[model samples]
Target chain A: MPNQHLIEARGVTKVYQTKDGAVESLKPLDFSIREGEFISVVGPSGCGKSTLLKMVAGLLPVTAGTLELAGKPISGPQRDVGIVFQSSVLLAWRTVLDNILLQAEIRRMPKAEALAKARQLMSMAGLAGFEGKYPWQLSGGMQQRASICRALLHNPSVLLMDEPFGALDAMTRETMNLELQRIWSESKKTVLLITHSIPEAIFLSDRVMVMSERPGSIAAIYDIDLLRPRTLDMMGSPAFAVFAKKVRAHFYSQGTLDH
Target chain B: MLRRLLLLPALRPFLLIILLLVLWDLAIRIFKIPAYLIPRPEQVVQQLFAEWPRLLTESWKTTQATLGGFALTILIGIPLAMVIAYSKLVESYVYPLLVFSQSIPKVAIAPLFVVWFGFGIFPKIISAFLLGFFPVVVSTVMGFKSVEPDMIDLARSMGASRLQTFFKFSLPQALPAIFSGLKVSITLAVVGAVVGEFVGSNSGIGYVLQVANGNFDLPLMFAALVVLSTIGVLLFVAIDLIERLMIPWHASQRQVF
Candidate 1:
């Protein structure tokens, strides 16, 4: 029997109308995310990686072709999908718990249940003492952790992350990777992360989808045979190097390696 | 240390006022300037105490008009900003008129308001509303426009309804900016009320200043001026306190010691 696909994209494309005329953002592309799978898309800046993710999240309209989540055609924002943007984007006026609870409040979830889930996600994200603190008080990495917890608060099946750790320093990025992997393992939610860093993409994803510059289309997809519970050690190993090389070769072919 | 820290901001301004008063007293004594030319700070204080009953009543009248106009500005300006911020069509229609109104000096319209509404507080309140309304509208429109696009996308992605997106994200995000407008407009509200009184009112601190000016009673003029400034300061502080309560999470509200 065929494996269950949670997210399906069939010849999806995006075109933006501008003062300079029509701009093709994403070329016709097809892909599917299996149930509880972790997928990452790596590409250069301005290569429509973000546009593709936004389309999938139903935040942006797909200009052409078909995209579906579960069995339904995605015409607008869906209830069972959550998104994490490049920045933490936590509201400065709200405490961490309040920011996380934003998702619950939007969905109109029961207050008692939402509060319980918020506390659980906070502790899981290692943000126990910081719940009542404002977002500005948390460091870059901690803020992003709280953002992830916020995305997961509603228990959505699909979590779409767009360069979630791109703002952090290298050392913080690595720690956040481990934290994310731990969260993913525990939650078993389908995640599609968009990133610029090759190693960051390979370290977190089950399969890495590489795309070309401008009018971005999938150039290649590599399935990682690396073991579960991936760590910093795995990034230094020979096997990880091989996967990184493959993802890099696509950027080289497109001559976008400089980006 | 804590007490010093708490009191220093208040203390510095108070000390400066005292030093200025001392300087003024010395200048008057050393130069032997006539009281009619410039009343010493003590004479102004004495005048304020001697005419306390009349001064208090006039100050109260100005205060009522200022507050009434400010309350009206909040009611009208915010909704006007909402309409302008949300719809480009409405903005194009309304924004030019707003700019045009500003071009005509609000003080020039104060007497017209008196002619239309008679010598009542209605003209004073209207003048205050006119002066206060523009800053509120402009600042609020700017605040509404400044909401980060990513924040809007985040709200939309969460399956938030249009109203939910506004209440949860847009309104809260615009709050600090809105408070900034309120702070500016509250001070202007006092000026508006005073301008109306200057033009034609028989009561209010502004009218007191006018009578003192005609009589060349410098001490009384100084006292009325002090009362006007006091009202401006108190209104500004009230709005500031409200801002602190409303948006303590804002970076501006974070106290550093």
Candidate 2:
């Protein structure tokens, strides 16, 4: 039997009231994510993918319909959710370890346990011997890793990442993608990652959801039948190419949407 | 490379200032400038050494006024910026008033302060505060407003309360920019204190300069000027050091040695 859905959205929409008029950012979007599943949403720039993630994370209010996380309607920012933004957004005044401990501080977790968890998360993210270093000393990729460690520090079951690797270079992005997959697998937390790269979505996600341009809505959701413990070498394989082509075909047929 | 790196801290600025001082001393002597017209470097330094006790007392008075004004600015300015940052209504009501107040030249108000508060330290402190207050308010407002929207969103997503978000994220993030304001305001505080002293004061570097001016004692005047400038530079550097301590993670603070 299929595992119960950890997150459920029904006809959720976002309308931003501007001076000009009411602007619809997201059309009615419906999707369900199972417990411990890795889901990726790929779309063009300004396609409202980030809006959908925010709505589910309870960071933004939905104009219509409903979004339930862990069987409760998301009204405001809930403690169980963790989000990583497009930029690392690490506080420049905080060191790496302190940055991770910020989540514990917010959640009011036990100090000793949080410190131990932070150390474990740092080692997992390959940030050993770098806890005392400040965010400016780190590369873009390392900063993103620190942010990810921060999000996971509180042991939140749901991870919402909005283009976490979008700011990194090509090589760094690939490495981060792999590292993210490993983290996701090890944590077994439900993840909804929003990205523009098709290969990245197909490479990391169990199910990839494509979004349309303006007044964005889900266009398609493709299941990746690829095996787990996936490596970069898989990206060169025919199976990976086929999955990537399937996602690309929708974008190309419509227009240049991916950015 | 090793030598260059070792000397990188103070070498270039030190050499350049020495060169400028040499040029200034030579130019005064070569021009056959009168003692009243221009004091040579040695004359100014000699005057500084000769009246060390008196000048030191005056310097202390000026320093006290500057510190008082700067502390008041920090007390009042940051909270004002916080109000502006948190509420649109407050910003709309207060921002215009701030701009209007800043437009009134502080020097013009210094004499008025003396008239109202009498010729005491209070007038100097108030004058210094008035002059130094605007930059702190303006920069702090900018700092709070300029926080990346995504960062706020990240805090919200993590279920951070408004207070938590402010204390943990917005306040710390705004620090580097706030320090920039502090750096500018502290030097201005020195000028503000002197301006108040110039209007009406029995003691202070400004008062000494005024006495020397009336007597045509150019060397004493130049000596007071040196002391004034040294106070401004030292205050600015102290602010810089605090910025480094508070926000070493900030990009602006991460300079190569």
Question: Which candidate number has the best TM-score?
Answer: 1
Q: What are the per-model DockQ values?
A: 0.85, 0.70
Candidate 2 CAPRI assessment class: medium
Q: When only chain A is evaluated, what TM-score does every model earn? A: 0.97, 0.96
> What's the true lDDT of residue B167 in model 1?
92
lDDT over C-alpha atoms for residue B10 of model 2: 76
lDDT of 1 by residue, B66-108 (tens): 9999999999999999889999999999999999988999887
Backbone clashes in model 2, listed as residue pairs: none
Compose the digit string of candidate 2's lDDT tens values, residues A98-175: 989988887889999999999999999999999998887899999999999998898888999999998899999999
Residue range A109-218, candidate 1, lDDT tens digits: 99999999999999999999998898999999999999999999999999999999998999999999999999999999999999999999999999999998898999
Segments in model 2 whose C-alpha atoms lie over 4 Å from true places: A255-259, B1-18, B255-257
Instruction: Give the DockQ of candidate 1.
Output: 0.85
